[model samples]
Target: MSNELYIEKNGAIATIVINRPQKKNAFTLAMFKELGALLDELETDKNVKVLVVRGVDETAFSAGADISEFLEVRFSAEKAKKYNDFALESIEKLYRFSKPTIALIQGLAIGGGLELASSCDFRFAAENSKLGITAANIGIVYNLTSTKRLYNLIGLSKTKELLYTAKLISANEGKEIGLIDYVYSSEEIEEKCFEFAKQIIQKSSVAISGMKKVIQSVVDGENEESEAISEIILASYCSDDYKEGIQAFMEKRKPNF
Candidate 1:
């Protein structure tokens, strides 16, 4: 797609970089479709087992929906819905991606940026990064999909505090509230986060993907053992990864999976 948003692959790990550093990696309406299409492409790629989403540099992860486009794109209810659908598709895909995703934030992750980071399985932010949702500041209401993701990550009261205040929180504060999974120095964030992604890819992809689905089902209010969930749990026994795991244990070696 556009150079403004592109993917960089390294072995089993692939990263989608938000490249508009000048705009703090702000995403325009068109970039949303490009992002969704990239996710679609990556989903079918056998070689990619982990995805990392980040900005071009350590300045910012993203500023969220480019405010400059709001006049033309979200000036009315119908226009807003059309525009939001593009973003919803991309973020939802990232949320339910078959593989794992990590969002590495450095300077800023506010507005839709914070929401996008919240969608990832893991969020690693630099020590002094600024994060928040500023929809209130612009007189715009945050969409439910984005709101629910934040709510799931940080819970009800904290989510309300964030939305109501429109205040930026520190990385440490984010961790304390469960919004950030890891915090490191700006210099250490990338190295540590990518190392984390590498570690995950070394595990069994089959197990990881299955658990992702099960965990999401639970998040969506599935508490009981449904037949579909049971099937996923049972099907693992027949997967090649399971066979290799058993063989490796017997042979006292690490599994190739």
Candidate 2:
């Protein structure tokens, strides 16, 4: 994996840090490729129960794609298409990740940055964080998948307003509009993120994974009565975690999940 995108595992929680503080963690094409590869590995790594994505510092979650590389790397239609495809693959992986995912946003989360945050299952932003999708300002259309994710999170009206205006909203506004799940002061954001992750890790992994799959299916418009959904429900019922949970409740003890 590229140094720009590194992972730090702490027991059940794996934190993916976007390390480009000098550039406000702006993603390069290589960074996208690395992220896609890392997600592939983490998805199969049963030890990682929760994933948190964040920038290395409090300055910015990400300034989005590095525009300085535009002329050299994305000046031509063919090149731009390839570049976008790389990012799309990475974003899709994050969106479809089976494990619980969270985005810890601190400062600026604009354009692609906002897209990255939206890909996660939950977004927790610092009170002063600024988030927006600014592709409209640069005369480029946002990717369809990212747009759909944003629309799903904040609804059609708010999504349209953000895209059309290209204005960054405060973290509080983001929470109000459903772009973020929670907001904390900048100093407390990281600590609060870990606290949230701890709560998630304490849950049964089997149930969490099953829930993630079923939720994704529903979001994709699959009916709850589908056979695939039923199969997942059945598997969860048969899992050891389920029995353990029942035993713990009866015994009045915390379950070791």
Number of the predicted model whose TM-score against the real structure is largest: 1
lDDT of each: 0.93, 0.92
- Which candidate leads in lDDT? 1
lDDT of 2 by residue, 69-100 (tens): 98988889899999999999999999999999
- Which segments of model 1 are wrong by more than 4 Å? none
Listed per candidate, the RMSD to the true structure in angstroms reads: 0.9, 1.1
Against the hidden reference, what TM-scores do the models get? 0.98, 0.97
Q: For residue 64, give model 1's deviation from the true position in Å.
A: 0.8
Model 1, residue 3: what's the lDDT? 99
